[model samples]
Target: MDEIQLTAAAEGMPNFNRRKALAVTGSGLAATIAAMVAPRNAAAAVVVNEAPVTRVNNLAWALARAMDDWMVDLGVDGVPDIWKAHVYPYSQRKHPVAFESLDRSPSPSARVAELEAAFHAEWAALRAIEPALNAAELRYMEIKGSRPVMGEMTPEEADRLRSTTVADLAKLPPNRASVEHAEAMRAYNKADAAARRKTGYGKLDRAYMKATHRTSDVANALLRHPAMTLEDLASKVRVHRVWEYDGEDFNFIMDDIARVAGKAGAS
Candidate 1:
């Protein structure tokens, strides 16, 4: 994408940008906090010592390596440009780990197994939350869209209906029926919004936003593969049941990624 589009995309990703900023500025603070909160009991210390930072490090390393292998399998040369442009910047912002950190870590095989287990756990959680996330998204669309729900119409159409009288209804033609329906729908939506405010819809909105951002991150990362087209990436997401709750938005994200990738390729 061009500079303008890139800027817009970055602006849209408020959570990602906020996290990036925190990662860059709060690394020291995070370390300090971790140290301060660390358990001092002998038994707790033993458990902590046995927790194996090396294993965690190795798992991270293996995940990265696996990504590299995937890139190679796709016949891409060097690292993905999107990784350099996006993911790597975020990672470096989050933690200034050295290239040799992976080499220094231990338990490579066990770490890989741990990674697989974590993936399964996360997948399970994602499935459990899918229905709620989907419902939240539907409600969010109702509050935000021109057509709040099925059979609803635009505000413009509603205005047209409001301007027409019952005496003029017959002369207003068949299209006016839609306008009348729209007016009724608008009233219904207005009442719905007021009711939603009292019932705490903001929490659901927040949840939907979080889920969208998380799904977008994964979608963008997958789209970075050189051989992956938008359709291919979207199919993979569907097959994996990733972002099943927000299929339409995820498809839009894939399109955005494809646009960026195309621009990058052309330049």
Candidate 2:
């Protein structure tokens, strides 16, 4: 039954491999989504090229990818309400929605409202899981934040370090402030590692990363396509599910989601 469902879902998608389909739940997941999300040039050796390329051409498919994500995740027939309001005919060939999405904000009112609601919901979920603590992380921040007279500073580095926080310095590079910032990171890494005795999956960070740092890459590849039936939706979710990012953060997906959501609203 699972095999049948997966096979059916793969139909009409750009490329589908039954053997490669993921089981949709487990500790192991990679690749199936890599195919769906693969760059256009990465799919296969290009035998053909369309002359006079344009932005709409690139966006036409990206729009599809964005929608595929929406359909599978939201289980909705259309994209968010904001996107639908922006569409123009293909002949007109202007895309305000795409511009705002790739850059930022849909409309001031809509984008703010949408992002606020989405982020509020997200933080609510994360806060619910809180009271979480990691002594190692705290220790890392502390050690990294320390300031002391050290031999390694150039006059510029020393001057900057005295003027600003180490955290602020870390964001600068090839500059006066960056010197101590890098040094601080080294101290922090050493202290953090010694404190934790483990570098990865420290429990709190992992869950936090899942909730915060994730990327959303798991929508079915069909793009702007709707599920034909309940079984179809299930199949789409399955073959599509294990294939890509389940916990992808909003930032990575915001552009695409905004594009599709706006596109859906255009009609």
Candidate 3:
């Protein structure tokens, strides 16, 4: 029995092997095994380390990615004419209802009202989940903040420093606010700031996720409606037109929804 250990690293995280044994007994076994195994191991490592690719599950997400790619390819200021020339053609071919015939759809005011109602419903659901979300956020902040700064100190070194600092602070004069006391206060404040910043960022991320999920839900629901054309759906949840100007691009609106629901089964 020959036991092989396979490992890979992705973003500093280790990947453990599932299969442990490959049995072989033949001439030139060592050479054969090495030839077969090295490339496989290397490929596995690369796959594990790579970031997840964005998937387009529906027409909406596909349109968004296409528009984004078009903008990147242009590499200059995005004027309406250029957008019509380069980007709109692709969208027209892919989703004609939304792009080729915008003027024949429902009024923007009517669509906005429907979208607002859906948004309000999702907002209520979010409020219901707020307490649990807040608790999880607090836990993340505590764990992140307490993580000892790496490189200069190990866990053991950090433990030693914390123990010594506490003892030293305890030996100071009880009544007098000495320099040591001030230093300790500053250290505490620094740690608190780090925790607060981390927590704030995490909160923002959660809020964004909540908003995205809500938007995705609304967009998906509208898309699924059998009677509505793509333009009708876009008008309801996207394509915000005001007076003579198109207030928001179709790509921007769809991209926002797609970011949250691009992958299949992302509700």
The lDDT leader among the candidates is 1
> Judged by lDDT against the true structure, how good is candidate 2?
0.38
Query: Which candidate tops TM-score?
Result: 1
Worst 10 residues of 2 by lDDT: 2-11
Q: What is the lDDT of residue 127 in candidate 3?
A: 38
Clashing pairs in 1: none
**TM-score of model 3 (CA atoms):** 0.22
- The 10 consecutive residues of candidate 3 with the worst lDDT sum are 1-10
129-178: candidate 2 lDDT, tens digit per residue: 32222233433344432443334557876676688887787675455345
- My TM-score estimates for the predictions, one after another, are 0.26, 0.22, 0.22
Evaluation by TM-score, superior candidate among 1 and 2: 1
Give the RMSD in angstroms, all C-alphas superposed, for model 2.
Answer: 19.9
lDDT of each: 0.41, 0.38, 0.39
Q: lDDT by residue for model 3 over 1-267, one digit each (tens)?
A: 011111111111111110111244344444443444455457558656554442213434655556555434322243221222112233344322221211222333344435534543443344334333344444454455343322344466456556666558656333323344556667766876666565564564467467547745664554443322333333333312211112343444465455435443453
Q: What TM-score does model 2 achieve against the real structure?
A: 0.22
